[model samples]
Target: MNRKNLTHKAGRDNAEPVGGGGRIRPVNNPREATKTRPAGGKDAKSTGIDRTRNFCIIAHIDHGKSTLADRLLDLTDAVPERERMEQILDSMDIERERGITIKAQAVRLVYRREENGDGGEAEYMLNLIDTPGHVDFSYEVSRAIAACEGALLVVDASQGIQAQTLANLYLAMEQDLEIIPVLNKIDLPVADVEAVTEELVELLGVDESEILKISAKTGQGVPEVLDAVVDRVPAPESAVEQTRGLVFDSHYDAYRGVISLVRLFDGELAKGDRVQAMGSEEEFEVLEVGCYSPKPTALPKLGVGEVGYIIAGLKDIEALRVGDTVTKVEDPAESVLPGYAKVLPTVYSGIYPTVGDDFERLRDALQKLQLNDASLFFEPENSRMGFGFRCGFLGLLHMEIIQERLEREFDLDLIASSPSVKYEVVLQGGETVEVTNPSDLPEVFEEIREPMVRATVICPKEYVGQVMGLCHEKRGVSVGMEYISTKRVQLTYDLPLGEIITDFFDALKSRTRGYASYDYDPKGYVASDLVKVEILVSGDPVDALSFIVHRDKAYYRGRAMVEKLKELIPRQQFEVPVQASIGKRIIARETVRAYRKDVIAKCYGGDITRKKKLLEQQKAGKKRMKQVGNVEIPQEAFLAAIRI
Candidate 1:
């Protein structure tokens, strides 16, 4: 390698000749490379001028998301000096372990396709947003989809379309983005392109010609899909005003405080702009303004149709709300932000510390989570299980993920209550109540209106009997059941929102296996004989243990909940009563039998270590629980009962 070659190399790998297209060649002369190599070496791609694109892919899980990304990197020559397929983008630790996308990952690639209508077959940046597929991570999916103007709906040719696939597709449509249907998994023998296309036309109501057949695994049809994305997905029509941008997402950065993910709806973000977001009056001289292709880098400016990150010189994430508008301090944008939707905090749950003294850690985790999720609302609320937070979530999955994240990410043990739906009630004294906790229920008879849900169940016509039976069991009133085709039927029900929420959907699926597809929306509230079945661990009522059920269903519901609690509730030093009661009458009762074996007998040798460990474990366990006379209360005992 000569000095002239080292001049272009700038940092490392002087012996590795630069390819014609500015790609790095494999290191041939180790000595020359070693001599020129900079301290840790530079990112071959990241070190070069960053390629930028703003787009998100929408597909069901297992429709070759990460594989498609892997192929793009290869075809675009994004990887060099390593034969390793290297990263699969979403193949993060959790994703690889679980084989599911838990978070959205961003990356940059150049399709370098025939430009077609844009003058010449040109090279343009392609920003790929790969998101999660499970229902629990739908918020992450929605966030990723919103970042792109075009969504490539990857449908499995073999598996056909799934309920969740349609759910995401409908959301993409609702966002009014261009929909490009790609038939994935054509390499498999079971690939049914025709069947899936027909379903897309009939079920999704998409035009037949709009679908493209592709295989992300065999590296087949991927280029065509890329072409479809460019030709079909329109360029962003209008840029947001001169305002900075609205905070689309955010996260807590240990050193950077809160790093906000902002989509440039309009205007340009310069290096030193002071922006106002939410009600927060922090004037942040923009420390760094660049788009995140999953990897953050400094950029000159972000125009319309760009997704990027902002490092505001502030430590509090609460200042930059997810849905709040961002405006430059001087001469703010005149027009209001576009397509601003009211993201209501729907369900509420109590997130308690199972290990007892991790309350501060729980708050810290929540603060970090809230930095990215503006719609999440949580505050300190006291329960019988000591002090915990009554946290708001978008849905059940949101509640579960937060709990899981606290445990997995923060190493804080948690006991969570069944999610409680927000209720609207008219009190006897003419005051209407919106209650989250069942403990807030009015003791006296009043017009109580629990939220009602409108749900449509798609199932085999022959199974309508079982479906109807299941719905009726949940106190569901069927509007009608219509046959779409020979074997398929759509059943409409106006059921108590509580019924649909609590294990009902899971039960419905269990009853039908993976075949039934259901969709639901909140239908305000309706008057019903609602009562809070209070669960008393011994004589004291555990507010965290209460569940609001219709008077008609309370008896059985309470009985099952109490029965489950009995199996889980720790045995007491003395006999303990776990009972569910409505008003003054006890409806269900279960007992935590007296401790037959809580203490270990004295032992010898290695047995002494086990016995002493058990004794210490028992002592530590006592600190986590409330001892009522002889009765023992487990932190999860109350949460386990709600079943929501």
Candidate 2:
């Protein structure tokens, strides 16, 4: 295929009709195609695996992976011209509005090669997977990489390589996949193509000529990217004659049940075949098979080396887990494929619904979302805030996205507690327990081990000092530093995940004027002098507002928490004291003064005894109220306290 021959028109005016007329036709029910079809069809398995190429587009956030994917779809005619739009694979409104890829999307494209001297043109099947670029969603990238043979390493020409770009590149290398370096956004006025090309050459150890410079936004040099995939990336090796497929991803559908996105490695999977999950050992009959032309277009079967979905009438999302293998029940593989390692959550928070009745609804929403996002973990929990779920996430952004999705998709009101990292607490008796919630901490513990992370920050050389200073304020230990280029530097640091989960990234960007890019990996746990600071409203501790902080920071953090609570809590009939304390010792306190009524206003001309009597009576009533009355903490107070 050539770029010059491709049309950039927006509508169907440039589109050719298939077997039917130009009129659109409704798709039949997918489950109706259960009968096995005859062999030797146009399927890729029959055509030979050499004509197929599986690859994924990986890059940092907002680096044009989605834009490049749009151009590829246009060039290959995989999408109808009328249906074309920017970031077509990003279906979620949050994703489109945020200008970031949250979930990884997969699509199958067909490209025809130019005619050779033999007077024959070859057609190739290109299975392209578009992955998220955020550090939190890197799990999606890893799953996408596992199902591909090559990766399009997209780098911004103006900004050059970034923290996530290197992170994703390492992931692709770990998979031993072929890397096709691509410099995107080259048409921008500020693009330093020569400088970025030098960086790529030095980092990838490839000739400068090997790097392809393309403006994905303008469709320049994009066809060559597809060509590289066809020429350089190898096809899937031949597999033994056994049916096996990997469920890289899955989601729930209201009408069709669970749709498992799978990549076939061995033998074909046809509709009506009995399949069992190798991990769960649960069996189910395949209801349908299909590929995503960005949509679920039904096919007779999914052949080897193909990326597609399978409908098995699975109603329970857990029945078909991501990273689980599916094999035929009659003839299963000798052993399951090496599936992905379990991803542990790095940050934990309490997710509660404002309305108590919506607890069940929240659980249902989380379950369906978990099917789509395997990284989300949640369990039932109860506290003074009422019934809620303690949810675990990959990072703060991941937690925010899930909360937004639940509210938008499920139409439920939710309140998220302060984010915390998992900590290992050793009891005085030498028993260790993991605590994800501050309220879950035992009364007495010998030592607390908090999870740590190694963070990488890349920025211009001018901001190196500012970046290091910010990290130091967050209790970060400097690991090392290196100059990627004469003008740019990369700094590495070891910091507690607790610090990163808060406003650390925001602070870093503020310090570097939004010029620094950051990424981090878990580095296990280390013992630290940590104490749980509890917040009290009128002498009663509020479990939701309690948090763990280093002993050195407890006083300052407690002071901040109480001060913020003072401003947020509404004035009451009785004086409400907002106090932050460690154990039985109060560290900080703020008072919301009682709303006094001028009982003596009507007795302005009365004697001194009358005024004093009224004042004393009013004081006694307030004292009585203070003894029996409970302080009502508003929802906004909890929200504001967590941010503090």
Candidate 3:
């Protein structure tokens, strides 16, 4: 590889990130920014790698890639059990409760070379990339595979091949990554190792003898898996070729500032050194350097083909993101490495302060979160809901996690809009207007296009009718349907992404008796009329009510959202008018009557302190409300409106 390849692009602008992973702000590693321009194109030059082993874990959800990693750290004595994390969730709180790795997490595992040769003095650095298996987060798996040379595919022996298991294998194959099959969960009584072996051979085209059977739950087969990684995954061409490293990820710690995750292709990183991120000017001292023991370990240096975390003064992880690079002392690679072409976000929502005076607090919480989740793009936004942020995420779950994080992690209350996809209106003049919030829909647009969702649902044949009925209710069209097994059918549909962001999936499953599984990907947009539909009680316009709907169904869904709002909202002293609109013009309208009675029904003469306390509580509650012009919008009003 030409060293100039990594250096030539030093002056060029950092490219955009595309697909489900999405883009983050750029941070140039100072060492990387000074590299000479590449002779050919933007690409990292290879480094010496007698110390390289690249591999990704491919397994269905709950197959325990994280658990296995925990054991790997302990088995290798990479870090004392006191320092290392048990499950490398690297995941936020929401991810753990949801039981999925929303983002692909990478870490370096240092294993002692006792099995292979050289009297076991040689230590092997295993770059372990854990990819998410859920279809919703499949894009994360793609990037994980891109950074690896091989895959340690874990399959449950009793369960054999799962839907996502097959999905991930297909992804791994596309990357041409060497596959080391491992049958896990052998600790179960019904574990059928032979059956799973045959299934793997037939489905993945792997030899039966190649599959290593293990019980990840019991720490079995982990050693063999680690050994296979060293033998099967070839080291980087050269770990000492050049001063090049790839910025595969970044995270922000309140105390550590910027913690950048990188794969060193050549050279090493040390403490008390000045360095810059690959794309931006954010510089930091090598506060600490350690392999992704998921625990902070103070190591002297990291060699090529190793994944490690760098804590710098630059705490904004977005700046030092995936597909970036690191170098020694302002000497970067010829050009920065490319991860995915660029990241594009499809789902969006509005987040606002639910209570008065918490606007700044909510904004602070969101900014703090953006420090870690670079994919969750956000900006200052003012809305009828309140002064807040308009955030973008990879998918609905991505959006939900950030919201949950804001509330749970930061303890700030917020009001959010239902998730929506960008709607592009290709006008007659070949121009397009992108609509995220329904309030942004252009006025009198001739041709409006909104996102259509593509979903694959698995439900029992007996409940097929129930599922189909639910689909039709959401105006989803059955484009294709197939039988996945004797009792299950996979149905494909195209619906508005907005329609199902809320309870559509839940309702589908509930109506079908929990037999339906739903997965969706945005399938572009369909041309339809959308409006800034506002809901009002009595005659007051409640800004919290908004939706993107076709002109045909706008009346019903709009009315439904308003009616539901009425039930959720407490009647006020004044009447409220719930009206739906397109710009200033009202298309449909509804109204909720004012409160007939609100004053306390009984007041005994003796309890003076109790009455004072009740009145104080009422005053405090009033302080929490937002004063929207003449309306004292209740805090619970916004929360109740979009809780789902």
Candidate 2: C-alpha lDDT: 0.84
lDDT of 3: 0.64
Candidate 3 deviant stretches above 4 angstroms:
1-48, 77-92, 112-123, 134-140, 156-163, 186-199, 272-276, 281-285, 315-319, 355-368, 426-430, 458-472, 479-490, 508-521, 529-532, 577-640
User: Residue 400 in candidate 2 has what lDDT?
Assistant: 85
For each candidate, give its TM-score against the true structure.
0.79, 0.90, 0.77
Model 3 RMSD, rounded to 1 decimal: 9.0
Q: What would the per-residue lDDT of candidate 1 be over residues 1-644, giving only the tens digit for each residue?
A: 01121121111122221111111111121112112333223332432212334567767667777777777777777666355353467544656765777667766666776544766766666767887766445666666656566787787777666545755765665455567777889779877777667666665455666677777878888777777766666554333236546565777877878787776655567778777773455566787888654357788765544567788767775677665567787867664344234455557888888767888888888998777655467999886777889988766756766677678878887888767888887878888978898887778757888877666677766678888999998888887766554455677787876776558767887888656766555566788877888888777887777878788878987888788888887766556677889989999898876664546654545656788788788766654553525454565665566453
Please write out the lDDT profile of model 2 over residues 109-205, one tens digit for every residue: 9988776778788888899999998888988988888788789999999998888887787677656678899999999999999998888877777
- True-vs-predicted CA distance for residue 123, candidate 2, Å: 1.6
**Which digits, one per residue and each the tens of the lDDT, describe model 3 over residues 1-644?**
11121221111112112122222212322223323443112333333255567788877777777777767767877666566665654456666777777667776677766544546566666777777765556656765776676888888776565545655665565455677888888889977777667666655555667778888778877888888888876555432345566766666567767676776655567787676666775566787878755555667776555667777777454566656666665665556555454556777788887676998887667766655554567888777666877788777667767777788988887777766677887666788878777666655657877678666676667988888888898888987876644445667788887677667856975888754566555567677655556565545555445666666777676666666666665666445566656556666655555544333345668667777777676655544532342555555555555543
Q: Positional deviation of 143 in candidate 3, in angstroms?
A: 3.9
- Displacement of residue 124 (Cα, Å) in model 3 is 2.9
| Cα RMSD of predicted structure 1 | 14.8
Off by over 4 Å in 1: 1-53, 60-70, 77-98, 114-121, 134-145, 203-207, 239-243, 278-281, 355-357, 460-462, 480-487, 595-630, 636-639, 642-644
